[model samples]
Target: MSSSTPVWPAGHDRRVLAEVDSTNAEAARIAATLAGPTWILALRQTAGRGRRGRAWNDPPGNFAATLAIPSGAAPAQAALRSFVAALALADALTQATARPEAISLKWPNDVLLNGAKVAGILLETTGQGGTPGPLAIGIGVNLSHAPDPGTLEPEAKAPTSVLSATGAAIDPESFLDLLAPAFARWEATLRQHGFAPLRRAFLDRAARFGEPITARTLRETLTGTFTDIDETGALVLTTAKGPVAVQAADIFF
Candidate 1:
């Protein structure tokens, strides 16, 4: 970390690129060579992707970054970092805009501002020589621009930018300064305590809790009351059938 303007977190590496194909791709290419956790930020991404292979519309002023952490945890445990990243993202958004009340987290890695989509998270693992690899936490924020709603898939949340939503014109680098440290703090909490604390924290900021929401999986779509997140970070929905725990799905509200 650099001790310069926009004070960065200590014990972590930060690399800011003028442009890249994608921060997650860059992180995967450099994951094996890193000696410690590193944050990779790309001011512009020519080829960015979102969950389910959707294109990420990263305008020049928006945020595109990934935190590459060397990890040895099991795949299930590693996947839980999405929640960890979500908590950090919420914290950073609250700090940046000074509107904590406006920030809320959507399930399965989406951040909402004023009940609209403002940011998203994607997780991938990179390994070499059959050993456990680094976990890349890719985050994209609509800092200054958002994609047109017509381009979105059906039932996808409408997108909104920080500048438009709250009149906060935060640039990518300055936003990274806020995100990296906040992520570090939550990472420490996950390492020290467990998913219990993170689950509680995520639920506190969770959007649409106790409300009707629909989760779409590959096989079927399940609509139920958003009740809780379980011990393993599964979304617990109280459907008419019963209490169903969903491990992976696209949640819509």
Candidate 2:
């Protein structure tokens, strides 16, 4: 793979791979040894994972990547990457489009364009206790196309793509160029400022307050109304059982 620099924060190591089982998997392999920030950028993948062991669909022209952060950044702080990466993805989508306000983020990790899933983020961590020894954040964006809606997989209930929705082809490198800088800025902010501002910014983008939605997670599925976002980036919802805080859940409206 030809290496053009991706705007990264200090101590970040970028590895461009031809193929991988999964970028998150690869990042976990040597994360115990690496001291600085690092990520594996993959152009293609034979196999990839999604949240809760679901399969991640990786097509060329979309961004499929993983960022490995230090192990010490975890427990309560582990999920910080979701907002950090989502903010960058939001910025990336804006750079590629004339209309940026149309691009907003769904809590935890999903990029929405016109209220459809254009991209998804999956974060995994390894460590004893609550703190993560090393964190792997994998992302998949729909660049060239979203899957056929008629014969779509069950896992892709809300799958949408930039090209399919917009009907315009976007160069991956150009999109990445826009995303990397934004990512670098947010990463720094995440390390220093924490998730409060990120959560607020994300909520400003998520204008679907009190909207009836389906909530699915690693365990069960529930229908709830979108209420608000908490400081740690939990999805706050108003359910029949009253208010609930969800650390991770699949949101479908």
Candidate 3:
């Protein structure tokens, strides 16, 4: 991490838990009562989860936390914070490693270090009566350990850890100190300037940009050139037939 101390964002509450089933679940449970944005950190996450209902292996010494933010925007607008999270994540990793060139953001919600998967993000919102509620932005980083490759699905990118990749063994709380402020800055940028700037920033650090990759959805599989993220944050790719915008898919590179 940085040599200087990290400044926690103003007006944000932080809770460090010794153990929890999942930070996201806890965030969902307490979202309604939150007075302001809160960062929940779990030293030991027993039952963490990822996108598509996949089981996330969050060993001790890793980073597993969620930012619970109260919001009333439409799901689509609120969902755009994934980019905010990703950008913040990239910034934190770069700051920790001091090697900006090694940090890159993957499509959807992943962070790559030295071209391997090092972090992932999951977004969920709570609502009532069709009105959007608070949002939980769950983030996990392989700070000290990478799961066994055999445990992952076929064609999944190999996992790496901050310790392995950069020799920086960051404690969960120390990393959070770096992350929470970065997230606050990015969130402010999003609120003031909008997604255009964030999209451009993300694209600048996008992994496999202009590269050929495969996106697999429930109905079909598409292979195309990774192009741009649309206004609504959909993955835009140039396929053999034409350009396609994929709302949800498992991308394989």
Candidate 4:
């Protein structure tokens, strides 16, 4: 990493690794002793996992990183970090590709480029009870390479990459340099204006809103029309049973 890369927030510490099991796990290990925020970047991950414990195949030279921040918010509020991180990632991608119009945000925390998945965000937290401890925000972007569309998990969207979408290669380090400052700005916005403004911004760039979709929860599956997210950041699905506020689920369009 270059010394001139960009300065992070005041209490933020950054670590770059050649390889790791998972950046989120590494960030959590450090968060145990560190009081402030810590950013972890790995060149490659042997055992990266995504939402719902899905395997994240992190090839070398792609972007894989995690940010762990100590938070005082309740668990539901802390979960909102996923949206903030998603907005920041979208901003970074727009700067990298210089095509602001091609980038869009999917519900929850996925970033899409030309209707394909370019990046995904995973948010995890520590501590017990309603109030949580540190929150780990994990982000993975397909920069130089993307998996074959046929190889993606059954429910995952077709994947794309920065190189494929823009015909310009982007390395992990350079993407981090672009991402850190963007993240800091969005984090500040969230702290100041709360989720209303952030929610609006997210919806502005949201993909596939008001479309028919299926949401599969642990208990049952519901088919409904896609609707807006509520004040608490839950996905509101208008099903035959009426409006359903889904806190967590696998969605398909």
The best candidate by lDDT is 3
Compared with the true structure, what per-residue lDDT tens digits does model 4 show for residues 197-242?
8889988898888888887889989888878989998888899889
Worst 10 residues of 2 by lDDT: 1-10
Cα deviation of 78 in candidate 1 (Å)? 0.8
What value does the lDDT take at residue 85 in candidate 4?
Answer: 92
Model 1: CA > 4 A from native: 1-7, 127-131
The residue pairs found clashing in candidate 3 are none
On residues 147-168, what C-alpha lDDT tens digit does candidate 2 reach at each position? 5666555655567888867765
Per-residue error at 10 for model 4, in Å?
3.4
In candidate 1, what are the lDDT values of residues 1-253, reduced to their tens digit? Answer: 2234335678899999999999999998987788889999999999999998999998899999999887556778888999989999998888788899999999989999999999999998866565667888899999999899999997789999999999987889989988988888888999899999999999999999999999989999999999999998899999999999999999887
Ranking by lDDT: 3, 1, 4, 2
State model 3's lDDT.
Answer: 0.92
- The TM-scores of all predictions, comma-separated, are 0.95, 0.87, 0.98, 0.92
Q: How many backbone clashes does candidate 1 have?
A: 0
Q: What is the lDDT of candidate 1?
A: 0.90
- How many clashes show up per model? 0, 1, 0, 0
Candidate 3 per-residue C-alpha lDDT over 85-173 given as tens digits, one digit per residue, 9 for 90 to 100: 99999999888889899999998899999999999999988788989888899999999999999999988889999999999878999
Residue 164 alpha-carbon offset, candidate 4, angstroms = 0.7
Number of the candidate with higher lDDT, 2 or 3: 3
